[model samples]
Target chain A: MRADTEQDILKTELWWTALVTAVVTAIMLAIIYAGLVHHINPPSNIETVDPKTLHLTGEFTEGNLGTRVDGSQITSRIVATQFAFQPQCIVMPANRTVTLRFATPDVIHGILVTGTNVNTMIIPGYVSQVHTVFTKTGDLLMPCHEFCGLGHSQMWATVRVVPEDEFKPGPDGRVTCDAR
Target chain B: MALAPHPNYSAQVPPRVDDAVDDVALERVMREVPSGALALSLLTVGLLLLAWFLMYAFVFLPRGMVG
Candidate 1:
């Protein structure tokens, strides 16, 4: 009887161990499949810019800090300042790949778009970039996730994702919230 | 004639009568498999896996592609 009980315990433990291993393997396989098929990955761009002159003579200039279409590529350059994001709002087309580039002239800041996988941190000297495709069409809240200052609580921007037909850029190939 | 007890004498303690029965019960308990515990653990793990899959499918997958 003692030997029987020992065998039963060993069998049960082995079964549970196998089940746990299978569960973990399943999760890992799902993640790998998503990455290979859907191109889902974390944003890890390593580009540098001078924070002192970031706003003076670069792509992050005040006038260039919005969505612009260059040929078939859509890129939005944003500057996360001490308390607010420049432009305050950007417009992009749904179901199209868009590149969001962020830089900060002050302290560290981060942004995450609501209901989307667009999240990145903006360092003073580093340009954070995230390429994503927005499927839903609406004004999604893009909030500053990092605490910058006393006004950090109110630091947020809007991401207006419109339909492909309604995304009409001006002659300069730029789209802004005011244009909508 | 019986000898008289000393002033410091004490009575001997009696042994337990159910000692043999207790040993048998202990062996029986030790030999039994803990099916209830296994069932509970399996149920908890199953629920956790279900929750993870649900979030992955409904929330994470629907959020679209990003890099």
Candidate 2:
């Protein structure tokens, strides 16, 4: 009778352990299901500017900012891979918000808008967003915040803000670099 | 002459059941099972969570902008 009682105890203990394991597994699955079902299905992106606003996109080549500045597109001989990121001195209308989508192909960079309320990381696999209204009309330097390489300390670009009515086109109907 | 307490003790006795347990082998198995299982399970769950977060933030985010 004693041996029978011991065997029953062992069986009961095993059953209890198995029951606990099954309950824990069920709880984990329920949590994952909840996350998959209601956790914002996915992330989202905001169109922070209109189509008429200035939009620049290109590869940062070695030597200059590799973007055309002709009537067709804003192209420049500014090679960025070798030299610091020499962004064009943009003169946005006062009170107009400019949303610059900074991107890099080689390494991570930072778009630091001096004397403004915007600083962001420009990572390779991530699209960093910086939105700001030009409340004042002056020159703003875009400096690299992250220690990218040997020339990181001096890496920067220029952004020029101007009054609302001072923005005009050049002789060729294209907004030249000096139009502001 | 004291009746010898059944001198055929070895003749009619059932074999002794070995009830002694080896503590060393039990300790080794006890130490191995939980550690190995815990390491593998945690690694699998962690990787799964990371991939899920990245995909959700980047890929699906762009598509949601359509509507």
Candidate 3:
């Protein structure tokens, strides 16, 4: 009887521990779910693309890469190849939805923007996409998180989050940081 | 109750403060509603959640997006 009582007590304590653990885990999951549904968290929509000739044609061409803003729609396309990003910097307006798309022509690369939720892997044959809004106006660093080659340390870009008033596109609806 | 006469304090047996606590004592402690261990765990978890929420709302969301 004594042993049974001791066992019961141990079991009870375990139950309490388990219950608290469950509660904590559930709360964490709920927060993540809310973040995802609200678009405040970084998301990945992986799609395949040709790596051998990404820059030679398609949306990532020399004249096609950059921020394109239409009525309530803004898209930015970039090509990641070798040791540098094709368009080192792209100008975007703060507090607006921006779809950043990336494709790699060589080895794998990962993009991580400092102080933001934009992180995506750039596979050689895949297109990585992330949509987010910049609340603060500043120059954010975009570094190649994956080691590409000898120049991997210097492989970086910039996302110039300009103010709404400062983000002016040409008549052709293209915005580049170089335009400033 | 009558007070006992004082004897040689050093000669008297010393009280054992850290006596061996048996299963009975442990069982008694665990059987109590809102046991101390449970209270401590609850408090820790609550504080952690509070910190997480604060960081998420104030620091993370305000930093904005890649756009």
Q: Which lDDT values do the candidates have, in the order given?
A: 0.90, 0.52, 0.81
Per-residue lDDT, model 2, residue A168, is 56
Question: By lDDT, who's the top model here?
Answer: 1
True contacts kept of 2: 0.00
lDDT tens string, model 1, B6-62?
A: 765554546557655575676667655367787888899889999999998898888
The runs of at least 3 residues in candidate 1 whose Cα sits more than 4 Å from the true structure, single-residue gaps closed, are A1-4, B1-24, B27-33
How many angstroms is residue A130 displaced in model 1 relative to the true structure, after the best TM-score fit?
A: 1.3
By the DockQ metric, which is better: model 2 or model 3? 3
> For model 3, how does the per-residue alpha-carbon lDDT over B1-67 read when each residue is reduced to its tens digit?
9987677765696876877888677777656644666678779977897898888777766665432
* Model 1 Cα lDDT, one tens digit per residue, A47-124: 999999998988998989899999999999999997888989999999999999999999999999999988888999
Residue A172, model 2, lDDT? 49
- Which ranges in model 3 have alpha carbons more than 4 Å from their true place? A1-5, B1-51, B64-67
Candidate 1 displacement at residue A82 in angstroms: 2.7
lDDT of 2 by residue, B1-67 (tens): 4666777878899898876767667556655665676567668865776676566555433222111
The lowest-lDDT stretch of 10 consecutive residues in candidate 2 chain B is: B58-67
Chain B TM-score for the candidates in order: 0.55, 0.53, 0.51
Please give, as one word, the docking class of candidate 2.
incorrect
Sorting all predicted structures by lDDT, with the top scorer first, yields 1, 3, 2
The DockQ-based CAPRI class assigned to model 3 is incorrect
